[model samples]
Target: MEQPHFKSWPDVAPTLIAVAAGRAPADTVIRGGQWVNVHTREILPDHDIAIAQGRVAFVGPDASHCIGEGTEIIEADGRFMIPGLCDGHMHIESGMLTPAEFARAVIPHGTTSMFTDPHEIANVLGLDGVRMMHDEALMQPVNIFTQMPSCAPSAPGLETTGYEITPDDVAEAMTWPGIIGLGEMMNFPGVIHADPKMLAEIAATQRAGKTVGGHYASPDLGPDFAAYVAGGPADDHEGTCEADAIARVRQGMRSMMRLGSAWYDVETQITAVTEKGLDPRNFILCTDDSHSGTLVNDGHMNRVLRHAISCGCDPLIALQMATINTATHFGLEREIGSITPGRRADIILTSNLTDLPIEHVIARGKTVAMDGKVMVDCPHLDWPDHARRTVNLGPARRAEDFVITAPEGANRVTANVIGVVENQAPTKALTADLDVIDGAVAGDADKDICQIALVERHLGTGKTVNGFVSGFGYTGDMAIASSVAHDSHHMIVVGTSRDDMAKAANRLGEVGGGITVFKDGQEIAMVELPIAGLMSDSPVSEVAAKAQDMVDAMAACGCHLNNAYMQHSLLALVVIPELRISDLGLVDVTKFELTDVIKGSA
Candidate 1:
């Protein structure tokens, strides 16, 4: 049997018209519900909806006339009938699950639409990698729109990706059926300075009539920001404050407030809509990244909506932010974002607006989930052998390979460290004085400082650049290693013991690619992400369980930061702010230059 999808209004319009006029029977009829109309911002009582051929045909005070012997009737019983939730922006790979598994996980939570950026896979596999993601996403029962990745290195010249995306790639991707637009342009400096590659990608997207995403990570809303806006990104999800949200909307960019597994940015920016007088239409909600554990335990867009409502946003307004506003932004308002006639029959039933318990979910006129359990099958593609062998650790390692050699005969030195900020994407550039032992600079776990290294993974260089990081609060002879490093997709290993670090890195190499934790020279937990070294094609529940074990391992090592694995993966993202590690070395992102990890050593 074929998976059902919306075939556009024209393909089903005649049937829809016949069903509404009682000349043909509806496939399904939902009766006696409180219609939560997002377009009019009203909750009208005793409404009915008739669905046929996966599209809405009639929505009025009564739809009983369209029901026949073959129609499936759902008695809403006064439950609130709202349009299915939509995620304005996200990355499917961040969940550590492929598109099929991700769809299965979120269907129970009533997320019917997702606008995803596959930049993580793009950094590891280039244009072909994006195409693979697109094809699998189209196979899902939900709407999973892919955005062509715009930046592979994220910050060119600072790091090298496995494969770079070209303007020709952008032009070619625009023709794909599932390609919604260009992904987040992380090279704000390039855009502001008029870099040819950045402008060309933007121009190609605009010429193809697609949306261009934005990522202005800087706090500055100055002329540089104006230039970036002029360079043409239609929306931004990197805003961290009320001012940032206001500034983006003022410059005609949609301000997307995100609440991912690690990023809790909604409360600060929702003030732009809840308190300030900005039009709510320009404010949107998203989850830039959510690991499997978060998606399984907490929720998806439903969690974000509950958070927004708790933060003083009206329920209707919050739903609009996640629904019609996102739909209208992607130019998809006519198709999937609402419960109006001519739109796909995607909806959710909930008893309360505040708590938002997802009671039932319908997509493409079919009941996919009921009471927190998915009833439909989400399928996966058969991955080839090459896709499972992305982690390329070049050579054998020793404890000495993880060592950061200090200056000749030095006892102590001041070193620049990457400081983790809890629940945020930005890191602080910090400095700490550390002890030197046997001509090697050693991290003091007592001071919450540990050795951080970025290993060259893609091209099989045995090179590793070592630095220091704080805020994990790790103790004992423990190490945490991952191949899911952001943007550049390198190997990041952080540990208090050099031997354990070497062990963790080697284990990832042995498994092809994954995350691992080691302590007392034994493996404590592991999650194997063999696909592009970034995702697992396993069930989301299995992955989330292992992820929970990973969380427990991090906590057992005496490290406690909310979603520390997310912070661990982002240590290699050099485009965001302050300090980061790349294949080159420690990057002072504010200055956009590479500097010595040891203070004054340069």
Candidate 2:
């Protein structure tokens, strides 16, 4: 089904004027509702809204005059009528589903608008991948604006991508339909150092009057942070603390506090508005990455808004953060993010403000969902077979491919381990002492340490970089592998047994791309993501069910971390802090270079 094209204000002005003046009938009349006016931050009761030509024509104490025989009347029964929720920043591919499936999952949660960055696809398939995502996003019933991916490799010299996006690519994408802005500029060092490529991408977005997303992942609030902000990213979601949020807003940048499936950043940063008295207008709520399970079971923007309220933010203020604040940041305030006249008729009905329950959702004057069930069709693009065949691990990996050799005569050594921080993106730089068995390093399950390997899948390079990671708490002879590794989209296999590790890695290659868990040399659970090895072609419910099973399989193996699969997928994300693994070797993300896994050992 083709989505209704957005009507310009001028095109709908005549009908809107006629409806407001009672000279014409409205297409839909919602009566007996409490309007949540985000502009004035007020909840005025007994309000009525008249919509015409997919836009709000009139909203006031009564719209009875605008109602006619042909008008569809919705009796709200005094429920809170709030503008549809908007995601300030997100990734559709993170849900492990295609754009259509992702929208189907979130629309029931009242998320009518999203500003998405398809950089995940850009890494694996380059500009063609971005265009595919963009075309599909426009076909969805809800507003899904595309931001041309700015960072494919994320950090130029630190990592390698399947395809590289250039300045010309960014410039060309800015002119594409539905292209809102540039994706997150993750290379903070590049921006601070005024790298030509980073600046050129930022300049192109600015020249086209588009917003530039930011990802300054450092905790240092010193000169480097200042220089990065001065380089031109208008918003950031990488802030994890109240101070980080405060600094961003103080420097004229929107501090986007995110609460994805694994990321719990809103609680720590919402205090900036609740306690520190930062203007709520400069603060936005987003889900930088939410898996399919979270979208299907836990809810989307409604989940974030409720969490913010529980963090001591006023209910209406929290709503504003997810709605008007986000829309205004993107310069789309007048077109969306409000229940006022002339804006798109995207609204939600809820009985309570604190524990917000989405009873009904209307997008573009059409009721798309009601009571947790999506009513409208989210159109899908014909994803070709080439997009599905992304994993190309040159040769069959063997148990020997995952081995970590120790120094010639060393019996024990200290190894740099990637420590997974629970509910946060940044990993802790940690070290552990391990014994050498047969000139090979052994993992200590008692200490929550496991072996990690990065298998090169882009160039058919069959290279595996081995390292150690903590915090999975796995104690069995099991392995987990995923091709959804962030930024570079390589394969990350973590396990206690090299045999199981190799089994899991090869299984992913056999399936073209997906996440798989192997226990005792047998597959326990798996989700086949044929689309760029990062997303599935299945329906959202099917993908969510498989993802939930993957989580259960991990827990069954004594691996217990909130969304451990998400942590597993990010092990190769070389841009994040502390430590990571890549095709080259183990990366010291703090230093942005490859370093030895075993310290002080040749």
Candidate 3:
């Protein structure tokens, strides 16, 4: 029952105006640049930006008016001075690194702002877990806003979470200093139907005057979609096509296009702007989820921007999408989006607008990254021992835990298999026929069938749900296991060999929590995700190296799907379509009901 110190936008307005009028000594100044003004969608040449006390002061031909003694000046060399990129929606835990490490990984890529939802951790450790992430995010130099996780189990009764988020929790979080809004309301069905709980959360966010994030995973744009919009989510990031983008914007929602480690959605959706010529301001760019490997090896928002350009989006338009569009969506536009007066001094200097190689990065009027490297120290949180020790398998797992028994007297049976779709989150509802061996249903690798298991890791529960999956092209004697399963964050292990699968699963239990790959009952690779059994405390490069080895191990096993590990982990996500598994049982995602894993007919 304590209130935190809060600073509203109006409180900083006076200081900003004083800085702009040259009445205050500028803290930093960037000289001789072409300013990319996203506010008016115009490029102003020969602009000089002056900063004071971590806020933009003046932007004009010359900030000679505000220049004072000892002011640090950065020569832009006539390059494009653009606002630092903002990921409209993302998951820091997906990087398999803590927020500190994730920030260190993306700073060089010029992402100064992020709006993240820690639903994965919420499903694992609940509100305390969310608070850990929220506190750590605030300690960083860049802007990182926490949207109170709207869904813990994701889909109400379809899956059970370690802890459930209540409407009271949502109301309490709205009072937090860092709570920007509600996290993505993944319950599209509940929203459309006006579910009381969902409506209450939205009403709480509205009462607090904050934004509500959206996730309409279904491609259906009919009356249901209209009903969802009427329920009050202001933005959506699940759009994969131009039509999806256009429809969301048409219904008074900002269209968020994402390009994550394995998800290539921006290129397909940005065409709504470049070719079809939809208003670019309504679209925002994000990397929804990127692993540490992708964060270190490739880039963050920079990668999204590059893919947007290849898709024919004008460079400035793409920059705008990554900047002001995101800021405005979160109601932080005047506070930090544009590099204008009365905004946070978050700016990036690039040599070429088209290529966009980030040269200098500044956040809060301080040089944070320079020459493709982080210049400032990204702070870390003091994660307690219990926080890292989250994988709670009641006892050691055994091969017998994976055996699936078919219905009585059934020699062979057809089963509903969760099909892994490469490079996308959704799975296909695939059915496979399998033969019974010794009264137990077995996976048929020759038929491209493999076993999928969801292990209950929260609260020392020994529940394990075993099912089947396909489309990995996996051949003989291999298995993959991950503690990074989506939403619920349980351990999901998939393999052609039961012994290898058990080895991979047991290895994670031994290491506290992490991902492991095995071949013929021998471990080949592992990445230690000790933080809530979902992210690594290790450096991005070290984690990326292990991730690469894990990928290579999957390739050696004859599985040829792109980032198949990501797809495999999502098999238990009951929210996404077709079929999925959870701690309870196999989920018929389409109907949002539990279905028998064994097939009655072909």
- Please, what are the lDDT tens digits per residue for candidate 1 over residues 98-135? 99999999999999999999999999999989988998
lDDT of 2 by residue, 194-313 (tens): 999999999999999999999999999999999999999999999999999999999999999999999999999998889888789999999999999999999999999999999999
CA error at residue 358 for candidate 2, angstroms: 0.7
**Quality of model 2 by C-alpha lDDT:** 0.93
Q: Roughly what TM-score does model 3 have, to 2 decimal places?
A: 0.96
Per-candidate RMSD vs. true structure?
1.3, 1.2, 2.1
Tens digits of per-residue lDDT for model 3, 1-602: 11122234476667667767888767788999999998888889899998876878789998887778988888988999999899999999888889988888899899999999999889888888999999989888888899999988788887778888888989989999889999999998899899999999999999999999999989889999999999999999888788999999999999999898888888888888988898898999999988877888888999999889888888888988999988988888888779888788889999888778989999888888998788988778899988888888887788888899888888889998888777888888888889998888988878788899998888777888999988898887888889988888889999888888788888898898888989887888888999999988777778888888888888988988877777877787787788899988999888889988887633
Q: Flag clash pairs in model 2.
A: none
For candidate 2, the TM-score is: 0.99
After TM-score superposition, the amount by which residue 542's alpha carbon in candidate 1 deviates from its true location, in angstroms, is 0.5
In model 3, where is the ten-residue run with the lowest total lDDT? 1-10
Candidate 3, 172: how far from true, in Å? 0.6
